[model samples]
Target: MRRWAMQAGLCLALCAGAASAAPAPTWRGLDPDNTLVIDTSQGRIVVEMRPEFAPQSVARVKLLAREGVYDGLLFHRVIDRFVDQTGNPNNRDGGTSSHPNLPPEFDFLLKPDAADAIASRASDGITGFVGATPFSASQLPRPDGTLRAAGAYCAGVVGMGREEDPGTGNSEIFFMREPSRRLDRSYSVWGRVVQGLDVVRTVAIGEPPAHPDRMIKVRVMADLPATERPKLEVMNPRSAAFAALIRKVRAAKGADFSICDIDVPSRSQP
Candidate 1:
């Protein structure tokens, strides 16, 4: 009984160590082509869409935004502490662009030539960062030696929506207000909010908000006039400082460490 108690105490201590908060991160400029600006009833939210993981989804979103298809779209479906969903042209639950539905890019295969900074590894899989986005992937190789992985659905993640078939997803999108484990791999995460998360959280919450907030204007950074452009940046997770950050977080979290716990540092200037 005494030995059992001692082991339990030790386990508790280790778990406590694994839950500690990490220090802040360093920063770098964002690529304008990959950046998007959304002005909503709540305020402005800027997202950095990743083409490396979901090129077609990113392209579709970019096409819709540049063409003013998203302007005045309602935050049609919102659920508190979950997601702020919108981009349905009809301002109802279901709508899509004239474009054909897209196949899911729920997870992508990482070739050896891919750029990534691993945070943790196990026999079967690894968790790490790929351009400020956290990802979990298998360590086992495919026939081509590439690894399969999906993004960690942390807060502020932007994902496309589909009602029935995964392929039905087109212009609709949603933003994470909190970490959603179940949504990972079920939805394609194409981008994350680098700034204005507070605004995102403030959006009216309801299955269909009683007074739903609407996107006043949405644009790809490249389409915005120079004067209207907002500059955004994220701390490079692949850098030496980020390596220091990983060590600090890992030491603090111990066995509890997860890539989802690392908040990629960012800044925005309007």
Candidate 2:
């Protein structure tokens, strides 16, 4: 009995030590100069914002997150095999941030090679590129028989979330509808779902009742007390293969591929 108790005590002590050593959650690939961490009740959603990419949009989101404006919100929109959209703080109708909406920041004439080179160079620390860039469907070449650029304006397919009226994205945000290949070059992908995807998947939908799933609260890691502070790590820029692939696509077509175009590899548990 004494031996068993000793072993149990030792295990508990080791577990506590391990917990203390665990790294805190953080936004990856974030520029220390400007970044925001969105802490939801479900888990932490880190955002490495690019004010240079979309200044007004990033500012709005940062302001909302910082002011505790998104607390007690819900997911609101969750489609199976698609994305889960949120940012409605009120939980009544769709919620907008404290500030007024701005006009759209659409730049449809980005050159593919130029964009690729810029991204590659930026990742190499050669230059500083912040904020998200805009894209248009007409830039992507069709893969089918036509082999021409598809001229569709599917906004929110790849860039920062905003309404059609440009500068309309307030507190509300949406995830990808799917692995959208068509959106590869036309939208700014600010961040991705790193954890709690299952929570997103499990959110209750709305229709007849019109309640939809909601976020209980949204907090920023920086806002939390030091005892509850999260650890952060920056993601390395695209791998060589990824960078080369972008170059190849840009050469064949006339647009750069969005991060959504890449497949996420599966990881094994330790």
Candidate 3:
């Protein structure tokens, strides 16, 4: 019994020492420079833009949001267990937007350094974070020996909605409720919902509800009163803690794991 107690005590001491050696988790704060807040009847949905992935689309979204074009817009089409569409001032299919039609910006080629930092590897592609934004990428080796990559369409992906003519997308956007791999590299994915997704899930159901729920307001966090702006932080995907999390998740899911299965955990200040 004394030997067993000694063994237990030693194990506890070792664990305490190991815990002290481990760095405390660090969280990166939200950059209002590219953050947006969508106010709705349900609640507020926060989005973080990834201009590096889709510069033109991100520019257009920021332009429209600054002009207040997204305010008072209705979620015209919300398919159950799928994506929800909005961002049209006219609130109808095929209606014109105040902004000019933006050319398609499907994906971007990552810089060489960006390619080397890839974290999660899957049969489909590699996943990593550019800042706090989680992205899955398909890499291609260039003739010059450099690598190029395109973004993946995972859950919470903010994609520009276009008509039959793909280049016609201007002011319409859709939020993915699930991973729609079919749309990856085919649509202009510009940003992702980083907070308040529960509000997105609660968006009123409708192919077009008789009285559809509307956006109460939409503002760039940078444009809001300083004190009114949301304070949010996301887990650093490049951190040792994040790598450990991925390993634990992979161990649990085994071959079934996909990059979309992991979310960069986040918290918003009250």
- On TM-score, the leading prediction is 1
- Runs in model 3 deviating more than 4 A are 1-25, 115-119, 122-124, 144-146
Candidate scoring better on lDDT of 1 and 2: 1
lDDT of 3 by residue, 41-136 (tens): 888899988888788888888888888888899999987667889988789777767768988787676544443124565445556666545566
lDDT of 3 at 163: 92
Across 1-270, the per-residue lDDT of candidate 1 in tens digits comes to 754554344334323423337533456777789988999999999898888778899999999998899999999888888999999888877798988899998999875445346788776677777677777887665655566888789888889998878888899999999888788899888988888889989999987889999999998888778888886678876566777788899999999987777777776643
Model 1 weakest 10-residue run by lDDT:
10-19
Q: What's the count of clashing pairs in each model shown? A: 1, 27, 0
| Colliding residue pairs in candidate 1 | 18-253
The whole-model lDDT of each prediction reads: 0.81, 0.43, 0.73
What ordering of candidates by lDDT runs from best to worst?
1, 3, 2
Which residue pairs overlap in candidate 3's backbone? none
Candidate 2 shows a clash count of 27
Distance from true location, Cα of 243 in model 2, Å:
4.8
Please, what is the TM-score per model? 0.86, 0.53, 0.84
